[model samples]
Target: VNRSATEIAEAIDYVGGILSVGAATDLSFVNVLVMRDSFDFAADLLAEIARTPVFEPAEIERQRQQVLSGIQVSLDDPAYLAGVVFGRLVYGLHPYGMPHNGTPASVRSVTRDDLRAFHEVHYVPNNTLLAIVGDIEAEPAFAAAERVFGDWTPRELPVSPNAELPAPTRRVVVVDKPGSAQTAIRVGHLGLARDSSDYLPFDVALKILGGEGGNRIGSVLRTERSLTYAASAEVVSRRFGGDFMAMADTRSDATAEALRLMVDEVARMQRERVSRRELENAQAYLAGSFPLTIEAPNAIAAQVLESLLYGLDLADLPTYPNRINAVTVDEIQRVTRAYLQPRQLSVVLVGEASAFVDDLVGVGFDDVEILSIDEIGPFLTRDDQVVSVDSFSPLLPLVP
Candidate 1:
C-alpha cells in the first residue's frame, strides 16, 4: 500500500524517529515499514492504533485528497479498469477483492476516529509481529522494541476468525469500454499462500511462463505471435492464497486471439513441464542474480526483516535457492493439477466485447454478461461508482 518513494521515505523517517536514540533518531513507523511475519498483530502496537492514534486532521485531509485524485485517474484508464475486473473475478468476497486504498465512500467517511478504531482493532501487539534488520544489534533492537512498542498492556479483541472463500467457478466478465484502442486480457486462477507446500514449484512454473519474455509462453505469445507487446504471468503470495494472474494489453482487434493464446499457454505448460535446460537456466539466473541483489543495504535489510517476521533462522534463508533449483518436473505437474484446475476460468476482455464476445464463447468462457460501469456499481464501488487499480497500485516504474 505504500505506493511512492516519498511515501516510503516519509514512513521510514517516521519509524526511525519513533525508535532512534540520538538527534539522528529514526522516525516512527509511518516512515519505516514494519514488515509482518504474518498479518497477525502484536498486542501492544495494536492497542495503541485502535484507541490512541494521534491523527492530525490536516494530515488525514491531505491523504483523503491524495486518494480522491487517485480515483479519477483510475476511472479514465482502460487497462486499470481491466485490472479491477480481474481482481474481482479471482478474489470474490475477500478483502483482497476490495481496493487496498479505501473506496471513495469509505475514504470520505474515514475520520481520525475511524483510523484510530481500525488501528486498535487490527494493530494491537497480540495482532502484530515485527521483523527488524540492519547494523543494529539484538540487545538494542529489543530495547528499542520495548521503548517504541512495549508497555502495550493486553486488551480484549474480536477473535479474527478464518475467512471463507467462494467456491471456485470460471466465468468471464467483460467491461465494455466502447471505441477503446486496446484490449486488456488476464487469465489464471487462485494463488497459493506463501506457506503452501505447493508454493516453490508453482513459483518455478510462474517464472517459466511469464517471469521473462524469452521463456516458453512468452516465446510463443509475444516473440513468435507478435500479438502482444508483452505477456506475463505471476503467482502473488499474500497472507492467504494470493491471486495468480497472467495479463497482456494488445490491440482491440487481437483481443480474442490473445485470450485463446493465453489459455493455450496454460494448457501447454500444464501438459509439458519445463525442460531440464530451461530449468537449469532459470536456476543459474536465480543463483547469479541473488548475490548481487544481496549487496544492497535495503535488500539485506529486507531479507533480515523477513526472517524476523517469519522466524526463519540462518538455515532456512540459505536453503531457499537450493530448493528452487531442486524442483522436479513432477512437482510442477502436481501443483498444476491441484491448483490450476478451476472448473471455470474467469475470462475477462475489456474492450469491444461485441467484436470478440462470440470468439470468447467459442473458446469456452461462460461470458458472464458484460457489465456497464453503472451495473458494476452495487457489486463493488467507490462512493457511488467504481474506479480501477490505477488509483491504488500504480504501474510502478521499471527500475533503470
Candidate 2:
C-alpha cells in the first residue's frame, strides 16, 4: 500500500505479471495475469491496488494531462466525433450519453478528494467479484482470495440514479467538418438491455442485419452498390440498457445515398422475414464461436465473469452452443418485430455538410440540424438550443 506507482509497476514486472485497471459504463475492474509460481504475490498486489489506491495529486495531474491529450486527438477524428454525437442522440440525458472520458472541463475539475470519496464508496468486499482462472484449484484459489481481501470491510452501496432513456425518434444531425473528404454515418436507436429474455434472438437478428454470420447491411451497401468500402451494424448491450448502430464511411458526395440505404436495410429487416438459409448461417456462427470464447484460461475467465456480472446462470455456459442452435427463424422474426424501431431512428453524419446537405432531401431526410465541429460541445451538453441549418452561420448557403 505504501509503494509508489513506479515501484508497483516494477514489482509486477519482476514477477512477469501484467496488471491493468479499466472502467466501463456499468463496472470497473482490475485484472492481473501471472504464472502459478507468482500467484501469492499477484493476489496481494491486486488487493493492494484495488483497496488502497493512493490517488496522489501529482499522479492524478499526470493522468489528467494524458486523458486531455487523448480528448484533443479524438476531436480531430471524424469517426470518433460521429460516434459521440450518436450516443448523445440515442441516450439523451442518460449517463450513457456522456463520454466515458470526462470532457476537458470535467476532467480539470476532478480533485484528489473526489477520487478518494469515490473509491471509498465503491471499493468494498461485498461489491466485488474475484475471478481466478488457470492452474489453480477451487479451494486454494478461494483461500488466496480470502487471505488478501478478508480484512476489507463492506459498505452499503448507494442506490444508482435512474433516468429515463429517450424514446427513439427520427432525427438527423450532421456534424459539419469542413474540408473533410469522407463522411462517417451512424444509424439506429435504443436496443434491449443485456438481461432481457429477448437478447439472444434479437442478437441473432442483429447479426443477420450487420454482424459476423450474416450481414445484409454490408451485402447491400458494400457488395451490391459499392457505396462505401465497409459497412456493418451491431447491438451494444450494457447492464441497464443498450443501443443498435449501423456505421459506414463513404465519400462526402455519397453520404445521403449511403445513409438512405443503411436506414432502408434496417427497415427491411423488420418488414421481411429472413430466409431460412440466413437464419441458419447466423445461428451456426454464434454456435461455432462459443467454443472459441472459452478456449483459453483468460478467455474462459471472461466468459465466466460476464455471466456472473450480468446475473446469468453459470450452469448455462456449457449449453451455450445448444441454446444458440435452438434459436429459430420464428424467434428471430419475433424479436425483430418486437424490438426493431426502424421508423424512429437517430442518425449522425459527420463530414463536409455542404457536399451532401442539399441531396439529403431527395433521400427523405428534410429536417436536418447542422453543427460545426466547434459547436458540438455545447450541442451535446446544453438543452433547448437548436443549431438548425438556418441558425448555423457556416451553412448559410443551404438555408437560403
Candidate 3:
C-alpha cells in the first residue's frame, strides 16, 4: 500500500480499471470501475487510496502547480470572471462566495501538514457513502465492501461551521476589459436549497425560463431580437443554499438591451401564468428523459446515490415521472412569485465599459461599480469598498 502515485496508476491500468477522485460542495468521492473479474482487486485499491492516502510531498507540489496553472488560464476567461464575481455578489462571505479552487495566495500556503489534518478529520467511515454498481449480486457486493472496509475505525466528525448568506440586493458591477467586442452578463438572485419542497416546481420554472424544455429567454434574445446567439437560465441547488442565474453574451453596443430583456423575461415569468402548452412541453421533456438517466448500470448507480445523498426517498425514484407530470401552472406561478426577485437581482457585466456604462442608467441600472479587469482580485478580497473613479483615467464616471 506504500506506493507512489505513478505506481497506483500503473496498477489500475494493469487491471483494466479506472480510478478517480473528485470534490463537490457537500461531498468528496473516489470512484472506481472495473470488469467483474477484477472487482476484488479494484475494491482493495479503492480502500487503500481512500483510507491511507500518503499526501506525498512531491505529488502534492505537482498537483498544486497544476491547479495554479489552471487558475491562471481561467483568469484570462471573461465568462469565468463573470461567474466568480457574480458568486461573490450573491453569497457574500459564505464559503460558497469564494472560488471552489483556492485562490492563488491560498493555494501557495497549503502545507503537507494541513492536508494531513484535513484528511484525518474528514476521511471517516461515518462520513462516507459507497455505491457499487455492475454485474454483481447485491449480497456479494455488500459482503465485499464489508470485508475491505469493515476494519476502518469510525471517528467523531467535526461540527460544520455555519455562515449566513446575504439577502438579495440590486447591485450592478461592470468589469472593464478594454477593446473587447462582446459583453458577458450574469443576472439573478438567491434560490432555495436542494432539499426544499419547492425544488421541483422551481426547477420546472427555470427550465421554461431558459433550459431545455422551453427557453423563453433564448426565444426573445436570440430568435426574436437577434441580440445574441445564446442565452439561458438555471437554478443551481446545493446542500445548504443555491442560486438562480440567467446568462448571455452580446455585442458591446447591445449589452444594455440584452441585459434589460433578460431581466424582463424573469419578471414576466413571475407576473403571468404560463400557457397550458408551455407547461406540457416542460413536463413532457422532464418525464420523458427520466428513463435515459438510469438506462445503464453506472447511470442507475449515479441516480440512486444522488437521491441518497440529498436524503430523498429511494422509493420515489420510480414515481419521478408522476411527480413531474403532476406539477401544475398554479404551482409554477406560486413558486416563482415566492422566490424570484426581479428588482433585487445581482448583475455582472464584463466588457468594454466605456461602450455601455453610459447606457446602463438609461436601461434602469443607475447605481453601478466599474472595476478594471486587473482590479478583480483585490475587489473580491475586500468587503464593499468602492474603487475610486480616478483609478481608471480613461473611463467615464465610476458610478451614476
Candidate 4:
C-alpha cells in the first residue's frame, strides 16, 4: 500500500494502457483507457484502486510535498496570480474563490485521518457516476462494471454549505512583481450560471466577441493594433454562476493601451449590434466545429459526462448545431446589453509596480491599489491602502 499509486501505474503501463487521476470541485475520478484485450484487467485495477486507497503515511507526506511545491510554482506565474486573485475578488467567500489544490497552510494541515474520512464520506456508489466509451460491447462492459463495482455500498452524504455571493464592484487590483518585464491583465465580472435561459445566445455572442481564430478582440488588439501577440476572451461557466474574462500579455510600456483597447472592444459588443457577416461567421464556425470536439471515443465520453454533470438534456448535444444556428442577430444584441455590464468590470494586473503604477493612474483608472504576489490569497488579501486619484487620460498612442 505504501507504493499504491506507483504499483497501479506500473500495472497500467505494463498492459500498454493509460491511466489518469484527477479531482474537480464536485468529484474525483480515475480514468483508464486500455486496448480491447486488456479491458478486463484495466477494469479490475481501477476498481481496486478506487475502493481501497491505503492512505499510507509516507505516501501522504510525498503527495503533500508535491502539492506544496505545485502551489509555490503557481504563485511564481503572473498569469496564475491574476486568475486566482480575480476569482477571489469576484466570488468573495464562495467556494469558487478557493483554489482547487487549497492553500499551502491548508494543504500542510491535512492528515491521513482527514483523507480517510473525506474518502469514506464522498466515495459512495450512490454519489458516483461512471462513464465508459470504447469499442467494447454493452454486455461485456456491464458485466465488467458489475464484477468490479457492484458491491460498493451506497450511503447518505453530507450536503455542501450554501455559499452566499457578495456583489463585486469595479475596482483595479495590481500584483506588483519587482522586475516583471510584461503585464498580465485579467478583466472580467460576474456572469450567468450554467443553466441560464440565455446560455446558447451568450455562447454565440462570446464566440463573436473572442472565439479563437478571427474574434473581435484578437482582430482589434493583436492583428490590427499589434499591442500583443495573443488576446482572447472567455466565459468561465460553472454550476452556480460564472465570470466573463478577457486576458492579454503585453509589454509593460503598452499596458494601459492594451487595457483600453480590450475595454473598448467589450463596450462595442454591448453598444452596437454585431454585423450580419460577423454573426453568420460565428454561427457557421460553431456549427462546423461541433463535430470535431466529439470525434473520438474519449471525447464523446467527456461530452456525455459534462451533459450529465451540468443537468443538460442529452438531446442538447444532437440539437447543438440547430441551437447555435438559430441564434439571431437580435438575440445576440439583446444578451450583450443585458449580461455584458462594462460598468461593473474588475481589472487585475500583474506587472512591475514602478513601471506601470503611475501609467495606470495616468490612464484614468479608478481605485488603483497595489498587491504583492503573496497577497493573492483567500479573498485576495489586500496588502496596501488605496491610492486616491481624480482622473488621467485613458489613452496612450501605440504604433506598429
Evaluate all candidate structures by whole-model CA lDDT and list the values in order. 0.61, 0.83, 0.84, 0.77
- For every candidate in turn, the CA RMSD to the true structure comes to 8.0, 8.6, 8.6, 8.9
Candidate 1 per-residue C-alpha lDDT over 1-400 given as tens digits, one digit per residue, 9 for 90 to 100:
2123344345435544221111101011221324333112222332233335566678689878998899767766776777777777777766566655555676798788866665555445554444444445577556656665677665566643355555557777888877878888877777776667677788877777777422665777778889877788888775455767888888877777788888887777777766777767766766567677667444555555444443346466667778777888788778876777544566667777776777766666644578765555455754433322211110100000
RMSD of 1: 8.0
State the displacement of the C-alpha of residue 18, model 2, in Å, after optimal TM-score superposition.
1.0
lDDT of 1: 0.61
Query: Rank by lDDT, descending?
Result: 3, 2, 4, 1
Worst 10 residues of 4 by lDDT: 391-400
Between prediction 1 and prediction 4, the one with superior TM-score is 4
Residues 224-297 of candidate 3 have per-residue lDDT tens digits of 99999999999998777899999999999999999999999999998999988888999999999999998866
What's the C-alpha lDDT at position 270 in model 2?
93
lDDT of 2: 0.83
Candidate 4 clashes between residue pairs 3 or more apart in a chain or in different chains? none
**Residues 228-304 of candidate 4: C-alpha lDDT, one tens digit per residue:** 88888888776777888889999898898888888888889999998888999989998999999988766777677
Per lDDT, the best of the predicted structures is 3
